[model samples]
Target: MKRLFLVLIPLALLAGCLEVDQHPHWVKGQYAGKKDDLPFQTHFHRDRLSWWGTISNRNQHQNEYNRANP
Candidate 1:
């Protein structure tokens, strides 16, 4: 049992090192879509009065450009 574990342990460690030099498919640009484009995009519309008010208030808080300029 001890001899078997010693041989198996080195083989397992060496197997992990073999993958160190290989790059993943995604990093090599194997997936579709433009490189600069977001993976997902969402389009939202405010159809309700409450939603409109909430989104509007959130946008105001997030509007750094106006706050910075003012």
Candidate 2:
């Protein structure tokens, strides 16, 4: 049992060291990961004014005086 453990433990430790690196491959000046879509594009259907209005309302609600007065 001791001999089995000694052989298997070294083999298990070496298994991890032998793996190939998983760095992303880049295509000349091209992004290789997730595309960053604008929040307004997805959530507000690209209506710039509506997105700004929603942001303004959110910020106003976060103010302590606004909450107290309203």
Candidate 3:
């Protein structure tokens, strides 16, 4: 049991050190609008206000006044 644990522990630690790419290959500039585009440009657009709109919409859902009184 002790020998098994000693070998497994080192293998587990080495596994964490391995580099892994979580994103799909197409995300690495293989698809349209991915290459030559600033990251999060759509989310931070001035006219659309995508990020702000999402936050405000979420807040509205959480607001007590917006919910039906129990």
For model 3, residues 17-68, the per-residue Cα lDDT tens digits are 8798776556556653445544346557644467668778999999998887
lDDT of 1 by residue, 1-70 (tens): 9999999998988886756555434646575445553222222342466666767898998988866865
For model 3, where is the 10-residue window of minimal lDDT? 31-40
lDDT of 2 by residue, 18-58 (tens): 78988777789776888788999999998989999999999
- Local distance difference test scores for all models: 0.64, 0.89, 0.73
TM-score, candidate 3, is 0.31
Q: Estimate each model's TM-score.
A: 0.28, 0.57, 0.31
Q: How close is candidate 1 to the true structure, as a TM-score?
A: 0.28
Worst 10 residues of 1 by lDDT: 37-46
lDDT of 3 at 62: 97
Q: Report model 2's TM-score to 2 decimal places.
A: 0.57
Model 2 ranges off by over 4 Å: 1-22, 32-34
Identify the candidate with maximal lDDT.
2
Query: Considering TM-score, which of the candidate structures 1 and 3 is the better prediction for this target?
Result: 3
Model 3: CA > 4 A from native: 1-48
lDDT, candidate 1, equals 0.64
Superposition error at 18 for model 2 (Å): 7.6
